[model samples]
Target: MSTLTTAPDPTSETAQLVRRARRHRSRRALRRTSALGLLLAAAVVVRVTLGDYTVTIPDTLRIIGGADIPGASFILMESTLPRAVAAVLAGASLAVAGGVMQDLMRNPLASPDILGISGGASTAAVFSLIVLGLSGPGVTMVAFLGALAVAAVLVGMSSGGAKGGTHALIIVGVGCSALLVALTHWVLLRADVYRLSEAMVWLTGSVAAASWTEIARLAVLAAVALPAMLLLHRQLRVMMLGDDLAAGLGVAVERHRALAMLGVVLLVAGTCAVCGPIAFVALLAGPIGRRLHRGRTRLVDIALIGALMVVVADYIGAYLVPGGGNLPVGVVTGLAGAPFLLWLIVTRTRVET
Candidate 1:
């Protein structure tokens, strides 16, 4: 009766709170993933089934499972399947890359397309195509190299070398992008008609020429990069709290940031190599994913949303364009993203005011 009870352990309570928070985040992530997964599945079904050939969903499934469904088999195997796969891979890769960049930079406007990474890749690929006469994987390799080079340049130009603030990096990136885009245009102007036509279509970004080879390449890249990014998510979260705090919390800010940049470069380069810089999937995916999940941004959800966007956009370009000719997926995404970009600027201005 005279003795007082011991107080509860603060460490134990803190641990419990952390566990609860983790559990809540896990549940939220699962729900978001499930919803986005269903959307992606639907998009894939529509992409394969409702194309110019019109394969039934059942037939599409059967064909995918190695059943020869007579008329649908060839179409599904040769064109539609590869195209759909390419769109999904390209979109997911770009989205994840964009999400990583935005998270690292702590800027909604930061993305491969906006920050000159894609432009660098595109410019290099175009140069290889027209000036150097490189073909096949050579162009892809050059694109990758170009992207890495741009990343290096951005880092150097930033205020604190590789650990600079978001604004400096973005500003430098925009300047670099403008330069690269000008070079791309100059290259286009110098090309002969046939080569120019090919480059133009590629620059516009289409999965129309998607093949099994391209799919396999993307699959291999994703197999390596996606899991690595997932593992780095904790570090990314810490990094989000600013370098000083992150470093104080035992995060190697520069090293982790460099690693993240490498992953983003690989992803962006790979997608651009295959799909030729499909516009805005990277730029829009992170924000859309956040909105869909009630202001949470999970990389997997963002990737799925990006995949859905590309597939749906491609479908619309292929079958729904007012004029008969198919437009590039890039064009559709560009049209969509431009408005969103304007809205972002307006809202940001209003907020600042």
Candidate 2:
């Protein structure tokens, strides 16, 4: 019997390299995810236990476990708990939305707020609040519809088909955002003092009045949307290599892109409905998450980081301000985000130069 020897396939080395790279990325993502998860948990504990009306950790644990602690019970159940939950959900949603947008567009500057989804939702919400006199669930429904509509218009305007038309998308989105913002201002200007004040607070963003109903609504939206995004993770990773490459790999580029945009819209709309447009959480979360994981973007890490940012910012607004009066969470985030934005612009300019 003669033994036949076959030469090794030349592509095996490349395949091995690809597998190794993927495994390395997965390990890094896992480590970052674990770290962020722990940090987010700690932040939530701190947020719930430390406030104007402080609750000890043990007492908080007891309250969570169904123990009836005196002063802590009402405050925890009604106020701190709900607010913290809202912060986490809103932050995570915004961050995930932003990450998806950035990855889709391959533009660091692309975020739901910047691309007009949040603005559209805010405008619709304000109209519902002031003109239609809608509140609660009605406003949320309007906001969701408005976001979806704007996203559809944006995608159509950009012609983001098999190839992601990022530049056109950005231009159209920014213009639309400007128009929507102007309309929101006009609505606010014509409103009565009481309505104006309430609208302003909502526009500026706050979880101060967070309720169980709002929490439940956000929870449901997140439950539905986040898993969908996760399921699209492989497509997202593939698309990062460019549309043609992604399409060649058996990914339906346009379809996946549209699905990703839908997921982003849902996240942003739900967040806006619950807490209004909390500035820069989405914009900042992706970059921060990437940095934390040594420049690898993991969706879960981004979400956790976003949650941490919002929880910490809310804590500052509620407790760290000099006066007894609380600031809106948006105000704190805006203040923080503006500087970061400026730095980003300057750095980008430097890089271009």
Candidate 3:
């Protein structure tokens, strides 16, 4: 009778484990979504509370709801609100771009900044300023083209390498970035003092002067690009399993990767054109989202985390600067992101060893 007993099938037990894992992941995603909503509410409160003349949270709510606060209306509408909106948009856009790139490349360190998107935009913007004296939309247009060109070069190089991998892409991007940085500095040194001042602002990145016009331009660009990004989300997850696995799963590996790269290029270009190579928002957001959500991360969560960080950082810079002049959010992000970058490098090296 004891010898007649049988154990459960191993495959059945494995399937059960997978189902449980999927359920856990789903629950985690939902909790993260709720947390993100709370963080967004907090960000709005903080933004409304900080300024030369702070508004009470209740009054800020009224103002945001379109009720007029006579003396504060102009400042709130024309300056603070627009700037806050820009920060939110820029943060979310960059973060989404970064998360997509990381997943597509299957590399923790992959980001728009790392992949030469921002550098490409910077090179073109600098050229427009120093060579053609172009400003406004013209500069942005050139920058957009530059980002496309650089991304094309990167993909081309990566595919042509002996063995295709994320490393090749990163290497090509880093090489291009190094060359572009040198050229940008040269252009800056050669420009007149006045133009140099303008270029300086572009290089440092600030959304302080965002207008309805600028926001509209970004909105239009995002309208075309955002949906494209969302379309790639599932394919991008498949892509994380490597080209062979993705292909086996019915993904057109090369085609999807190319299209995904193009989408990120458009996103980075659109944001960089308006905000001027915002430094570390892209680099930091993906990890922050992962940390917040635990395990797998969603595109929306990453975007929300990025947006929240940028707004909070801007608020900090506005308050911390002794003379009341705000530090560019890019600079603040760079400072905060450097340590994270260093840690990634160290951990990566240890893993390799």
Question: Candidate 3's C-alpha lDDT?
Answer: 0.81
Per-residue lDDT of candidate 3, residues 1-353 (tens digit)? 36776888999999999999999988878887888979876886677667787777787778879999987877677877787888888888888889888887677788888878889988898899789988678877888898889888766765522156778778877888898899899988889998899789878878877787887888787778777787788887887776677788998877887898888887888788788888878888887777776646578888888888888888877777677677887878888888989998898889989
Model 1 misses residue 191 by how many Å?
1.2
Superior by TM-score: candidate 1 or candidate 2: 1
Expressed as tens digits, the lDDT of each residue in 222-250 for candidate 1 is: 98998898788679888777778988899
Global CA lDDT computed for model 2: 0.88
Greater TM-score among 2 and 3 belongs to 2
lDDT of 2 by residue, 1-353 (tens): 99999998879988999999999988877887888899899989988988778899888888989999788899999989999999999999999999888888877778888889999899999999999999889988899888998899866654445233666677778898999999999999889999999899999989988789989999999999988997897798898898778889999887888898889988998889889999999999999888877766788888898999999999999889888478899999999999997887699779979
TM-score of each: 0.92, 0.91, 0.89
Models, CA RMSD each:
2.3, 2.8, 3.2
Error of 2 at 335 (Å): 0.6
Q: What lDDT score is found at residue 269 in candidate 2?
A: 83
Index of the highest-TM-score prediction: 1
> Per lDDT, what order, best first?
2, 1, 3
Segments in model 1 whose C-alpha atoms lie over 4 Å from true places: 1-22, 158-164
Task: State which candidate, 1 or 2, has the greater lDDT.
Answer: 2
Decide which is better by lDDT, 2 or 3. Answer: 2
